[model samples]
Target: MTTVTLPEKTPAHTGRTPGRPGRRGVQPLALNIVALAAGLGGWALLSLLGFEDLPGPAQVAARGGEMIADGTLLDDVAASLRRVFSGFALGTLLAIPVGFLMGWYGVARGLIEPYVQFFRTIPPLAVIPLAIVLLGIGETPKIFVIFLAAFLSSVVATYQGVIDVDKTLINAARVLGASDLTVFVKVVIPASAPFILVGMRIGLGSAWGTLVAAELIAAQEGLGFRMQQAQLYYDLSTIFVGLITIGLLGLAMDRLLLLAERRLTGWQERR
Candidate 1:
């Protein structure tokens, strides 16, 4: 019997995969380019339409250059970032352990939750006046504001994440001869990492906002202080610059946290 002979291998495709490198890269770049173009075009149109007071990209760029020349802008940014980092670090360190203890032990939960819940309702901004009265209008008040902002947001998330850990996995660990502390360290922490990272991101954002609010009353250097000065002088361009810088910095921080989360909890994400 004669049989038809077929080729050993199938043909190599010429087309790219749906989300492969070529197609994916082009799509996002094209979209971003279009958006940038549209935004600049709108600014130009607004200027032409007699919005003289509203600063456009070029005006903001020029203002940024002027601020860099003066050297105040960098100093302001450094001050704000330092305050935020210190407060956020301290708050998260305190909150995470307390939150874990509360979530893990019934007695701890009963003892601490009432205070946590009560304080969570109080606005961070509302406490600034009280902080100033007690701590005075110094670095203490600003740091306290950021601490409150980070603690309140982080504790809730940490508490929830610990409680939400899978009971079955914990039991499995116990059956496999793991002690409570061992299981907690190995299984519970890994299980809850994503949630913890998510909480940290939220707390970081809150700290940034609180830094601005805290600086409002204070004497000295920060992006918020710069913005307040600009407002007093009615330098709209400078105000815009301060705001834009805050947004960009916040965005960068969030992206950094996202990268950390992806790196640390990569296994969970894969599943």
Candidate 2:
């Protein structure tokens, strides 16, 4: 008998495990910090150059600090946050079901799509006058306008998401003995979740954008109201402070939605 030798087998590749992010995750955060620093540097450079009217980051920071000390900033923040949250919540709650109806049923789509499109064509700002005229110049008008902004954005996105879901998946679910409700709950909703979340994010941005105009209607205290007041005196520092505050608040809320999206859609693929 002849002696035989076998080659050694190589070990299996050990890649990064699921659910735990790798170095690529930290890279994005670092890049964001770098980009922010560069933006600030650019702003400072502009102020130093010929932009006498513009305030630098340091000046804005000092002005913001003064506002914080005066308790005005806190009140404004609270009021704006209340309106935004209330309006956004109400709009989204109503939008999801309406969007589902329009996308799922033919008759509902025919009746609803026309109005949705019509309202979408009209800017939420344009409704300010009507809102004030009808609802009165109070928190009602402000919240209503914000609700319109959020609702239009969210409903369109949701409707598109539902329509865009792969028809093959629905058919497969039905073939597998799934009922209409089960197919919608298990197949449609999960697939459409990303789109819905994206719509919500867009709606959030719309809400913030509409806020300044909404606050224009007999508003006393809000970031937007504060900015308008500062504008009369050309208080560049205070205006900058308000802008920065709104941007920061919106960024924080968007990040929260992004976190929710990632958690809910973890099974979805990423680049």
Candidate 3:
């Protein structure tokens, strides 16, 4: 009875770690809520401290209620949302292909990067006058300014992503007899997607700022226009309402993009 040898093996994953399933999520949200409350408290305190022109959260909420009652808030929200979406879509759609090309091809990069960098140095607001002159003081100007904002912010990010892709992966594809287009479509795009999403997020912020400037100078409606009108009469509550509305809108949009980024780039890991 030669009992040779017995081996004991340990399992890799024993059991679920308590409170480890997306635990990071709740803490940040809790912290954010705390921070928000503190910020509101501070603002209220300051308003009470002889800041006669400053409107606190309650005043802003009341103004918001009035705007909602009159339906101006709803109309302004819809109009601003439409402009942001349309312009952002147009800019991103164009930026992707152009960025991809510039990143992939040396000739394209050489020819296009100068113009891209030059135009990016010019503030989106700087182009408003030119856009207005050429496209007229209509939806076209507003949309064009937003488009420029998104385009400039995103292009560099897109190019950087493509450029930063692992050279080894590209070489491996080539060794496996993959064509240039096949390598780009199958490998490069997927690898660079995270960078593209970051670019898009930045572009979205730029779009909002540019849209507000355009609206302030020319438009008759939207949140920017509403704020401008409020400013005329020194209506602090209304001004506060407009500011908060813009902040909320931008934050919501950013969060939506962040969700999309997580879904789209699930292969990437975060700490």
Task: Record all residue pairs in model 1 with backbone atoms less than 3 Å apart, i.e. clashing.
Answer: none
Q: Which portions of model 3 show Cα errors greater than 4 Å? A: 1-26
Q: Give each model's clash number.
A: 0, 0, 0
The TM-score values for the models, in the order shown, are 0.87, 0.90, 0.90
Candidate 3 local lDDT, residue 103: 97
Error at 104, model 2, angstroms: 0.7
Q: Which ten residues in a row have the lowest lDDT in candidate 2?
A: 8-17
Could you tell which candidate, 1 or 3, scores higher by TM-score? 3
Q: Tens-digit lDDT track for model 1 on 1-271?
A: 9999976542345355444454435487689889989988998788667696688778888999989899988998899889988889988899899889988899999999999999999989999989999999889999998999999888888889899999999999999999999998998778878878898999999999887788976658999988988888899889988998998888888999999999998888462
Ranking by lDDT: 2, 3, 1
How should the candidates be ordered by TM-score, best one leading? 2, 3, 1
lDDT (10s digit) by residue, model 3, range 210-235: 77798955787899899888889989
TM-score of 1: 0.87
lDDT of 2 by residue, 167-234 (tens): 99999999999999999999888998998999999999999999988999989999999999999999
Can you give the lDDT of residue 148 in candidate 3? 89
